[model samples]
Target: MTDQQRAKPLRALVYGDVDLNIIDGSAIWAQSMTQGLAAAGCEVTLLLKAPVTTDRLVAPLDGAPGVTLRRPYEEKLLSDLGPRGLTPDQAVTLMTRLDAEERFDLVVVRGRRLASIAAQFEALAGRLWTYLTDVPQNVAEMTSTAVSELTDIAVASRFLLCQTEELRCFLESAVPAACGKSVLFPPVVVVPEGVSGPGAPSERLRLVYTGKFAPRWNTLEMTELPAALDKRGVAAELHMIGDKIHRDSPEWAKRMAKALEGTPDVRWHGGKPRAEALRLSAECDIGLSWRAPEMDASLELSTKVLELGALGLPVVLNRTPMHEDLLGPDYPLFADGDVDAVADTLTLAADPGIYGEAAERCRAAAARFTLEKAAERLRGYLDLAHPTAPAGTDPQRPLKVVIAGHDLKFFTRLADHLMSLPGLEVRLDEWDGLRDHDQYRSRELAAWADVVICEWCGPNALFYSQHKRPGQRLVVRLHRFELYAEWPRKLDIDKVDAIICVSPHYASLTRELASWPADKVVTLPNWVDDRQLDRPKLPGAEFTLGMIGIAPSRKRLDRGLEVLAELRRRDPRYTLAVKSKQPWDYWWIWNRPEEREYYERVYRTVQRDPLLAGGVVFDPFGPDVATWLRRVGFMLSTSDDESFHLAPAECAASGGVPAVLSWPGADTIYSRRWLHDDTAAMADAIHGIVSEDRFDAARLAAKAEITGNYALERVCSLWTDLIVDGTVPEPVDLQGAIAA
Candidate 1:
């Protein structure tokens, strides 16, 4: 066989985790990308983490001229950082060896670590493209000296684009030669469902989207898609691929089962190597992507779209231009903020002729940006030498973002958000312990740290058991989950400089739970990117009530469904929407006993709950939550517990009369003196707010504006000011105080 026909492995690394590869691995973007790369005659080596010797780790790529994998021993940044993360000496040595060897034709970096890029791209440009899965973050952190070191490699190395607008920008920038039309390809891992003929045909259009399970993704809101699909008597199946972490632990296997209970036609796949996911995706039709979770460019499409194409499935996509760019001309556009529009479009898509035609177009479009195309393009770039050569470590160090082990999403995401500011850097270290913190290292991290930001939730401060001097300023923002961690005593009361919270109740709860001196905690509300919020409300949008949450204990999906049933029974002009990230297959759940039990319990609770017999419906996910809320005349939050109702806050901002279900439990910290669990109060609030259309519209706009204050710009500024400014205030009643 010619080299064209000779099978080659396409070495790929996911950097971290995503759902696509969790089950049938195809749910991951890289899985598909790698599969495509392998199919095009490239060998693929995937780096993955697993508890044991990898459960069914080996996978396959079909009909392609290549190979695929799930390597369990691949080196992660932490291991290379140092033996125990003390110095970069080990990392420097590892990068030196990896780059000098240059085994892979291309090195696709997932989340950006400037040090990693500096090590690889600068010294190893001849071998790979600086492929970005997440948006780049360490540019600002590259010290002047670091910049000079990277300048040589960056100048010579090829650049990969993770965003469409950024690709457009690069086209107009000085580095156009370094990156050519930075088109995106999903991470390759093909799983042909391993199911061909004679398989039992399901009644529903099995729609699945698998990947990381996070809050801001608003993935839960996606349930609305199923609701829409259900209207045409089309039974629909939704599957969220990937493991979800419960609390701060990485044991995500059964994490999401709590929230996805009682919902019909949905399932969860525990975790799988990449290639397997593709095979699983093949049996199904339709995939989903809406970057409603955050604005960081890294969240752009990687593989989900391609899997859809590989299956000849049309995607139900978000309006983001990034995904749109990938869709090219093949995507059928849906109005930005209309569930009905989505319903209309999808209903039409369900038609085999209509969807198949569009799917074919998408397939043709997919070919344009497939792994074959991308690898070839990258090959052309790597053949050219770097504009600049490698230098030593940077002198003027980049702004160090001291990431404590807390709020991985918020911190990393915020870092990505903050990195957009002219000059900044982000770094994550495992040494940030409150009580057992190494005296010497903590001092170094803090001393070197330009900004020390801590998430509200995290692991034991036992690591900080050997506390030391505190130099850099600290900014702590609390998410709802942190309040539940066991030992509250180990929290670094003195090390913290700024206490931050996403909601007022979150702030209050921080004070009540941690009992950190009142002066130590402050509230800085959470904000979605400005781009994510501007979707226009749908005209004549009514009858859409959305309840989004992955956990039933806190989010209260059943209660919301109950309320919707009541309302819908009173007037048939009502639709209920629920979104979640659970797998959609019975066998998939049967494999995971913890998750299986979780679903069983939730199902029993919901099915047996007299109030919600036939009321609640599921949507796609939360990305278009505002759109979903606009469809509802009244929004209800009947949660038994909450850190702060993010969806309600968003719904309130969307002008939906948010009916917060008041229940008396741990009310002092999060709920304040508001009516807790009074059904009459819920009705009264809903009644009072629903009638004032004009006022509600203004409130919606105002809520958007008020919420906008929490945007990246504002949040980053809050972080920047706290980090750069010397003098700081202790936490106080931010209830009436103005925030940046």
Candidate 2:
């Protein structure tokens, strides 16, 4: 045989229970997989149980390349025997004819009923591959006669692998001929080319959700987001793309619509072409896929999340192991599929800066699950399962990097980065029982870790410090608030191998305040993932100043107001955007007379001052600070004190100039040029950037400083070194540390 003739593409037949034209997940999966296989140099033919029909509502397959789609049975067959219509004899006869004509190399079956029937075909046994889209309950029903004939089984998720093993064990006990054979083959989609860039900032944030609106999908929570955003004075709208009302539960749709009446408007563009749906999604600010935990909580991955991410939309999905695996634990917008949680997530997503960063991250993550990547992965599994394939080498065990914390924002991102490194097994133990002082979970997690990192100097750190076994390294990270709290005082210094402070100033402050050896305190700044933050500034951002986190009195909102009032007096265009939780929202503070008195003073001052009336904009705490910073010309740090003052650095990263008020340790954190001794000098610095054409230069300078000193990669590397190599510096004596 000629070499050219011997190198022909693999010929494979894909069989599924669903029709290709339907607008459901199964149909999409079937079509997309067929296309992917064809693209991967496979001559493919798709066989379906249901016959093709011309319906206006059905999505058209106008340009499916290199794939022959066929229906082996009619719709009437389905009516007689339910969804699994074809008889084993009929299936055998059809396959025999096809095999005779094409001499097929592989037969891929999708559903359990079809797989069981196909398994009985001895001629196709060695070349068969069964893909289990659902649970393996039906697969267990296959007789020993059929089981012995099967070649390989594939599931859509790794979770199904365990379930498959359980099924295999049960079957083996009853039928000796049954063999356990399964592998993971997750659902994949073609990443759309030249999709619109990350969603741009607008006067009103635009949110879109595409998929089924069934009760299990939590469509009600999706519908309620816009109204909740509106309640916070964030002008937003939801564009729901899909079947507006679930065909199965039309009454539930009516109730949802009725509930949303008089709230922010929701435009329902009923189901459209898949291409059109993605294009529409690309135009929106954020994508939502919050579903009830009961629905595919274990085995199935949400294809909607992938679809939205591929289209360049940041997704607000439910918190789950699958989602955390896909987007990282630190992905800002995760909820429990509750209306209130989803609403709060949407509210945070409204910030243009945060939205932009999240959108970028989503797109980057989506790239890994593309059809091409999925096809490659499938090919590897198929190659391994092939009779003539070569043996594979054993891989090294992964590094068990455990990050234990209550506040997971920074640690999540760090853990995600660490996970991508070679031979690492990263896990996040977010201690929610910090308030109750629970140590059970913390101790258990500490025992599992080769390297344990307590994110905050709280109960998690204290518990891990005392409970961490010998040979396990423990690291505690202290931020600004933790220094003031009693937790630091109670922390077991000797148990902790190292301490991470966000800045040199904080490092010094920590040594002075705490009894830890100075050398143990490593000044590893919080990672600022520059890729997520660095973006183009919005128009009029030069006139707008922004302040993040203004809850406590120490943040000095009154000083920020003074600077804003000074600047507005010079230029009416000047405005101050305060992105924080409202003071009154904190019940503990609102209940206290002193704290309430301070908040009331600020509220009265804003109410009385004419300059502050329209110039001051209050935005609730949100996730999209990066996007919010883009619309801010100057990042004002009017805090009485701070360890690292992440807000200014974040603003600079987002192309905003820093205008910091001089505090006790301001010089240690910021450049003297950017720092001001008083509000007038802070206003002067702001005016210099805004009026003297120095905005871009100042912004670039600040970004350069942060990018150089606190890049995410640099900080994460320090952490990786500490965890993997134990290369951290030895503790210096407290007396020497104080002198230094």
TM-score (all chains, Cα) for each model: 0.41, 0.50
Q: Which ten residues in a row have the lowest lDDT in candidate 1?
A: 385-394
Compose the digit string of candidate 2's lDDT tens values, residues 490-594.
Answer: 988988888988777788889999977888888776767675466556568899989898877888899999998999889999999999998788887678788
Candidate 2 runs further than 4 Å off: 1-395, 419-422, 435-441, 728-740
Best model per lDDT: 2
Q: Report the Cα RMSD per candidate.
A: 20.8, 18.9
